[model samples]
Every structure is written in C-alpha cells, then in structure tokens.
Target: PGPLSPSPPQLRAQPQGAMQVGVQARELRQPMAMAMAAAAPGQMVMSAGMQQLAMLPCIDVQERAQWLQEATALLGAEIEMANKYRVLDQVGNQFFYAVEKTDCCRRQCQNGLCADCTSWEVDVLYTPPGGLMQKFLALRRPCSCVCCCINRPTADVIDEATGQKIGSFRDPCTCCSLRFQVRDASDTDVLVVNGGCCCTQPGILCPLPCGPCAQVRFDVEDAESRSTVARITKRVPSCLSWFFAPDVDSYHVTFEHIQNPQWKAIMLAFTIFMDFRYFNVNRNQEQARDVLAEL
Candidate 1:
C-alpha cells in the first residue's frame, strides 16, 4: 500500500486476556520455586535443583524485556528512515504556502495598497501520514488561510506521451505470517502449527544451565496502531526443569525473554557460559565424592 498518512489507523479488537495470563503464570512460578526450596533445605541436592529452575523464569523476564525495547527502537529507526526519504503520495505531502502581504492586498483588497495590514495571512497545506505534515498541524493553529485547512485534492496521473490519465496505481493490502513449533531432544519430534497474525521466525534458544527439553508456544497482540496479535513458543525441557526447580546452587541459572532485541542473544550466550560453569561445578562435586568415599 502507498504510505498511509499519519492519521491514526483504525483500532481492532485485541486478544485481551492471553498476554496477562501468560505473564501471571510466569510470575507465579517464581514464588512456587521459593516455597519448594524452603521445604527441601536438608536435601541440598533437591533444593539446589529447584532454585536453579526458579532462576530460569527471572532470566526469561529480563531477556524478554530487553528484546522488546530493542525491537521498539528499531521500529522507530525504520520510521525515521522513511521520513528521511521524503517519499510521499500527493495526499501525504504537506508544505508551507506563503504569499506576501502586498500580493494579498493587490489581489483581494479594494485599495491596491492596504496600509493597515503589515503581513498577509499565510496558508499551510497539511497532508496526512507524513511526519512533516503532522508536525505542521500540531504547531499551527487553525486559520482563515485557504490552504491551511483544506482536505487533500485528488490528482490524476497522466501519461505525458499518451496525454491520458493512467489507472495503474493500486493500494496495497497488509499481510503477515506466523508459525509455532515444538521440538524434542532428538529434534525428531517436531510439531508445527502455521498461519497466524504475527511473524513465524524462530526465537533464539536461551538454554538453561541444565539443558533443553520441551518448547511452548506463546501468542500476543502486536503493539501497532492496529490491534494485530501473534503467537510464538519455544520450549527446552532442560530449561523448563531449571525454571520449575525450587533451590538455588552456585551452578543455578535462569533464561528469560524480557522483550529486548539484543536480550535473546545475550541470554543465549550467558546460558552457554553458565553451562560450562555447571560442568565445572559437577566435576568438582564428583571429585569431592570420590575423596569422601576413600575416607
């Protein structure tokens, strides 16, 4: 579609309860992990496991937030780039149209020279969708100038050689794609669901220190002027175990998606580092057990 003027798009109905429900479930899991840790303090092994799982939710939250922020910033940058191009249809362009006081007096006044009026009223042509026109409307109050408050006039596209109006321009329609899938450890148990309102690209894997096992799908409404929504889910069982565990150990860690763009990459990298740390911790534990056995 040609660039839509900056006038607010029509709002659509939103999937009201879904996002909140997912958030609440995520939040609830944290306290549940804490309770488990308290109950299994003597079982240091179990407590540690639970704590590790608890950390996953926290990490997921942080990561998600970070990605959301980054994505929003990127959206802003895209808009700015469009503005820099100054590409607009006739109805989407706005400009200042000023006439000197003398010209106004000579054209409209009974006397050729209107001595009382120092300046002529200036009319500003404002278009919709484009940022420049929006800004003009915001800054300039309503006035009597003919151009200042006029609706966009239609223009016919005429072929210079043929001297005929061409009817080739067509408005573009909005379209989107969304997909969801779950894969098991062997990567063989792949279940795919396709066709939704959002994009279908796979999310980055932020593996927990433990490992990956199951993936879940999540859907949420897009934050556009239009109330478009989308769904996506990735589950790693190893990560889920850590997310659900109750006790924290030196090796415990969590993976969260905090809606930040860079967060997914950062969290994924952090999780890989934590996995190495977990391996070292396990090696140390094994060595200590051997010594105890010998003693």
Candidate 2:
C-alpha cells in the first residue's frame, strides 16, 4: 500500500528539489506539443500540392512516366452527381482531394431541358486528404450554352485563402476543333489547349482526344508558337463493374516544361470542365431511357 497523504507539517519539511521536479514536468510538456504541431505534415506519404505542381519537365516519353499524376476523378456535374476526385500520383500518393460544390437549389433545378442546357455555376475545392485541410485552390466554372457547342466556356482559378483570381482558362471559340486560351493574372495568354475530333462538330468533348483509336487527350500548346508543351489525357477508371455507377473519371497530366505552379493547378481544373461539358449528357438520359421490368 502507498504511504498516507502527508500532513501540513510534513509537507513544510519537504525538500525544494521535490517542488522543482513537479514544475519541470509541466514545462517539458509545452515544447513537446509544439514539436508535434510542426511535425504533423511530415507524416504524409510524400508532400502534396507542392511536389505534384512542380511538374517534371520532359521533352520526350522517357521523362513523362515520372511526372504522371494519374488522378481518379469523377464526372456528371451537369447530370446527376456533383462529382468528387482523389488525385493520386504515379506511386499512389494522394496529391490532393477535390469535391464539386453546387447549391442545393441549383442542383434541384437541374431537371428537364434545363438539366442539359443549364450550365450552372459549379465550384470545386482542392485540399489535401489530411493535416490542416486548408484549401489550396477554389475553382469556379461559369455556365455555357451548349447548343451545337458553339458557345465559349470559361473557368476561373482563385487562391483559396485570398479569393483572388490566379488565372483563367477560356475557349477561344474555334469552329473546327476544341481550343482554349490559358491566361495568367495579367490576362496574357500563356498556354493553348487544343484537340482534334473525328466528327467535324467540335468543342464539348471534341477538343479532347476523341478518336476511336486515338488516346482521349488535349494538347497543351504554347500561345505564341502553338508548340506542344503539355497534355491532359483521360484514363479509364479501374473499377468497371458498375452498370451506371454514375461513373467518375481520371486523367494523366504531363508537361514538357512548366515554370509555374498556378498554371498546373489551372490546367487540372480544365480536365473536370471537359468531363462535365462533354461526357456527362449521355449518362444523364439513362433514367428516362432504361427499359423498366415491373419490380
């Protein structure tokens, strides 16, 4: 059994070192907490956002493999789902997480002709899977009229913390193929995203790699010389069992040379925009078209 509690008289006779030992314990705890706070992000598989955004510059196919961040992304913002994505690097380290944001009212309004025609504004928040979960980017895609794909569509990339536009991606309204002019904060065109289609009617998904044998992709070109600098290619999802799981998508984004992180983020947003505008309508009609067996 432990000794009984010391009386007041016994406590008065205690050594000064005993009192100091008690004080030292509490003081030691403060620094330990600070160290833990500083080390929390280091525990992730590899750093997110920073590492992926510093895209590996490659002039040939050999260097492309290392830079491939094959994202598992979702689609159908214009259809039923709002969409979500878990962007992963080649080695499966999560680069970032993205989820679509549309007002409940706006989502509910997505019905009838308005369903396919309404280019309702959709926002996507980009954040890491763990740690502080602070938003890295906020993407706002404005609505576009899709009647025969003649309209110009645009998306704005804003700094999550500051709410200021870092850059923008806009279609220059090409008639034969799909095209976009990626501009920086100063509105100077930095990159061009170009795509060719099998059908003459382009835009929508036409600007994306849409040939039967061709890889579904968009070539990121230099605005000045129209040189191919990067490419965003859509990859099929691994799980294909769902009849209409209202599937999401994934893409491999690569750069021949990229100097800015903001541009990388902006280009990523364009992939999601392409999915919603082009790949979404067909799946949306399934609810109305499916043959019903009386259950």
Candidate 3:
C-alpha cells in the first residue's frame, strides 16, 4: 500500500499536432502502440488515445450508414419533383405565348381572303377521349359569304331508311352548309348540307353555288398520314344565326368557356417563379442545419 501511492508516471505535455495525428490514426485503424510511437518524442499521447477510445461508444456506424442512404433517396425524389415542375413550367409558358399571339375577332380577318383567317363558325374536332379512331375535323364555310335570304336554315339528322330527319343543326345558312360522319373505322362521309352561289353582294364572302360539292369523303389512312383534316366551303350564308344562334355548333364555344377556368388555375400553380421560392427556402434551411451540426 505504501508503494501503491507512488503514483502513475507523470504525463508529458502533448505535442502541437498530436491531436490531429491521433484523430487520423483513429480513423485509419492504426495499431495503438504504433500511433503513440508516431507522436513527437516526449509528447504525452495517453490523453489523446483515451479521448478517442471514449468516442468509440458514442460513434454509431450503423446509424450513419442509414442516414447516408436516406439522404441519397431523398435527393433522388427531389430531383424527380424538380423535373416534373420544369415540364409543367414549360407547358404554362407555351400557353401564355399562345394567348398573347391570338388576335381578337374582327382584327383577325381584315383581308377579303377570310380564308386566311379562322372563322367564328369553325371548330376543331377530334375523336372524343377513349374513342376507337382518332379523327380531327376543322369544319367551316367553304367560301366567305354571308347569307341573308333564308328564313329558316335547319339541319335534319335523318335515319338512313324512310328519309326521316332525326337530329338537325337548328340554324340553317343560305350560303354554305357542312355535315360530317365517321363512315367506318377507316372512312368518313362529308356531305354539303347546303350550297349557294358565291355572289359579289359582299358582306361576307360566300362559296358560289357549286354542285352537291361531291361527297367530300376522307379516309382514316389519309388522316393518319397527314395529321389534319380541313374543309372550307362558301355555299352557306354567313347568317348572324350561325354565330349567335343556340345550336349544336355553339357547343364549341361553350366547351372552350367551360375549360378556361380550370386550365388557368392549373397553369398558374405550376409556374417556375412560384416554385422557386419554396425550393430555395427549403435548400437554405437544410444548409443552415448542416453548418450548425458541423460547427
């Protein structure tokens, strides 16, 4: 007991870089004796070695590996979200460009070649979603003529047998008329519902009376090859009824009006400027936490 109190060996002061060297050795798994020997001569290495040993219980290798894996997966998800946002932003920009370029009404058709401009009666028809065949029809007057004489322009969808009209386009035009049918999976039947002379009486240009305009037929093969189907005729009059009348054709305008609100909201939500703020804020928060932890 007397000699036991002689005490442990006096510890020497640590060298200037001994702490860094010990940290490196711990990370590299060098033998303890070799690491202590590598320290500067007369430097007390026991405290550094003891400190590293004490850290071993608190250093969770498994937890760190799990954290790295989670971080990688989160980064992948963020990148995917960014890509989707980019695509949505592009679509919004395109829609804005289209709206900006479109002309308002009468401004679109200053030239007598109303053919150069889109008509109010015109419609872009495509096969309803989920339909078998994809068909698009741009139906409008063949010529630029306004019809004034006809009192009652009507359309009658009749059963092929007995010539009975089933459904009709209510408003009739004296100058031009159009009707379309998907004849089969591969063909379409286009009938000139009405025809009139292309008179010089000029209010709206009318397609001059052309013979039954032939059965303006279209093949699905042609449509698939060309990607478009358009027909212009001037036989029907450009009656105010054509534009203002409540009829099936008016459905085009109605559909456009109905879709406007939903489309506008969708476009606004996906804009890049709107998304950038959230992305930047989240990134800054993550960086701040990382810095604090490192410190």
Whole-model Cα lDDT of every candidate shown, in order: 0.23, 0.48, 0.21
User: Under the 3 Å rule for N, CA and C atoms, how many clashes does model 2 have?
Assistant: 3
lDDT of 3 by residue, 59-173 (tens): 1000001233224333432111111111112112211110111234432342223422222221111122243321111112122343454332221221211122112222233
Please give each candidate's TM-score: 0.16, 0.61, 0.15
* TM-score, cand. 2: 0.61
Better of 1 and 2 by lDDT: 2
* Winner on TM-score (1 vs 3): 1
Residue 158, candidate 1: alpha-carbon lDDT: 20
Query: lDDT per residue, candidate 1, 1-295, as tens digits?
Result: 2211111111233357532212111111111111222343332222221222223333221111123322333333211010011211223331211111224222233111321222222111222333243111001111122221242111122212222222111111224433322221122211222324423322223224432213324333222221222233333334323332211122111222223211211222222222211111111223334544587
Model 3, position 107: C-alpha lDDT score: 23
**Model 3 misses residue 238 by how many Å?**
30
Off by over 4 Å in 3: 1-107, 110-133, 150-295
Ordering by TM-score: 2, 1, 3
How many clashes does the backbone of model 1 have?
A: 48
**Highest TM-score scorer:** 2
What tens-digit string does per-residue lDDT give for candidate 2 at 1-295?
Answer: 2111111111111255532211000011111111112233323221245344655332111011101111111222333445566666555555566666877555544544555445554444444456555466667766556555465666777656445676677766556576778776556666677766546333233222233422456787766655566777654332221223323345677754444444556666666666655544333223423322222
Q: Residue 88, candidate 2: how far off, in angstroms?
A: 1.2
